[model samples]
Target: MSKQFASAGDMAEKQTSFTEIGDGLWAFTAEGDPNSGVIIGDDSVMVVEAQATPRLARKVIDCVRGVTDKPITHLALTHYHAVRVLGASAYGAPQIIMSEPARAMVAERGKEDWESEFDRFPRLFQGHEEIPGLTWPTTTFKGRMSVYLGRRRVDIMQLGRAHTAGDAVIYVPDANAMFTGDIVEDRSACYCGDGHFHDWPATLERVRRFDLDAIAPGRGGALQGAEAVNRALDSTADFLRSTYRPAARVALRGGSLKEAWDAVRAECDPKFADYAIYEHCLPFNVARAYDEALDIDTPRIWTAARDKAMWDALQGG
Candidate 1:
């Protein structure tokens, strides 16, 4: 049979874990699915990345309630992907935050993304019917902004573009911990469908300079301590380079997208074959890397039709 499209064939539910990486901060992670971060401040809480649907988000809510009852005052999204933002309603947080550019992407392609992602992985959208609509940020900033939950100061900053043109990282200074949405994944494949391949490494470097003690990454297990944090950072950078270099070589040589796909697989599979979502992410990552090699600065929007076309083409590669 033809390879399943995206993650459509992978229906096994991931085992979820809620880890306390800092004083009051938690990382709500699944085996390899998307992750949500929790920051329990003095008087309230700030949640990072809303998950794929209200039902999935409720799982996060249940985890939060197990620890504290602080009202979720702010919902911060790292980027505009449906898997990250469509579940906004569940939070009931008064203030929703995103970078200005991220908000713009939501306007430009939110609906299309919602459809494409839902089509790609039906399992993630457990309660698709409950998703009211595209998620929008109530509060937006250009580069940096700070939100204080009573006494704790959480710095939400857009360091540079990596996973998306408008990715943001949430840093809690008092704990020296950060919530890096898809910008840094712990042994999970970085989804590059809307990514900036050429700019990703530099952005990772900027995140590294922070010298974080712990990180609630976009996916996979939580990273605690300087050594573990640094390793994930380095591995993420390596994954990007391994994916882009071979694809770029093929594109520069006037090769086809399928050729680029094979090139990337040959280069990346040996190293990252065991990583979470590696197969699900390969085609999209190769496509973007091929485009970037040709100097395509902006990632093209992905629609359901385009997703199918790309997957079919790569399947025969």
Candidate 2:
């Protein structure tokens, strides 16, 4: 029944690749695992999207050490997701930066989310006990915040809500590189458990304005050049549209949840089946899309118990 739960039968370790997307920009991707972007400044370094735990974070730290000895001075969280923000303590980056909405999310559901995600994906949280609890931002800002990594301008700005209300991207103007959190996924399936489906496309439209030379997405390989970047962004948009459109059509016709779910499966399964996390995310994605189609603007909080219940019902367990 969809691997019983999230990542239940999948526990194989992935080969990590730390590729330099630009002169001073690095992207750490592990097959289809969550990616962490690196920006090497003239003086200190800045890390984007911390892994799930302190032990897992050490692997990223080692990769950074292989390139530069510069102490990381900033840890930028793209959102308030547990898997992305829990490992922040390992970086020891003095300043943790997040948008005001992100900080609010951390306050609203950080503890519940932490417990929920850990249960869902146990392998990613190899050192769960070491986590110092929910990661909090040292500094919060609204709209856009300009960060200078020795004149290499890293712009931390909120485009809109896609993956979460607090979703943000780290943009390096000179490098023509943008580090997008779950707002943009390449080959991996987008997890919409806490997403805003209605607003996701508009947020992606804002991402296009950057005229990117390279884009380090949330998962999968980094995109190089404008053409590849555009294609990746388009792919993300297509995913959102294909799911929401069909579901909305069903909901509008007063169809049942199963009808809505089956409609999405028939349309999206063939198109997205081979993508990473496709199986794990389908039910959740459909549920969110179903709600959004009914004009539910905000995403509902997913607890561990709720996750199992949803999966059981949708998977016909």
Q: Each candidate: what lDDT?
A: 0.92, 0.88
Per-candidate clashes, comma-separated:
0, 0
lDDT of 1 by residue, 1-317 (tens): 24666488888998999999999999999998999999999899999999999999999999999999989999999999999988889988559999999999999998999999998888998779998889989999988999999999999999999999999999999999999999999989999988998888999999999999999999999999999999999999999999999999999999999999888889898999999999888888999999999989999999998988888887665
How far is 187's C-alpha from truth in model 1 (Å)? 1.0
List the candidates' TM-scores in order: 0.98, 0.97
Name the regions of candidate 1 deviating beyond 4 angstroms.
none
Q: Which residue pairs overlap in candidate 2's backbone?
A: none
Q: Candidate 1 — worst ten consecutive residues by lDDT sum?
A: 1-10
Instruction: Give a tens-digit lDDT track for model 2, residues 62-151.
Output: 999999998899999899999898898898756999999999999888888988888878789887999988899999999999888787
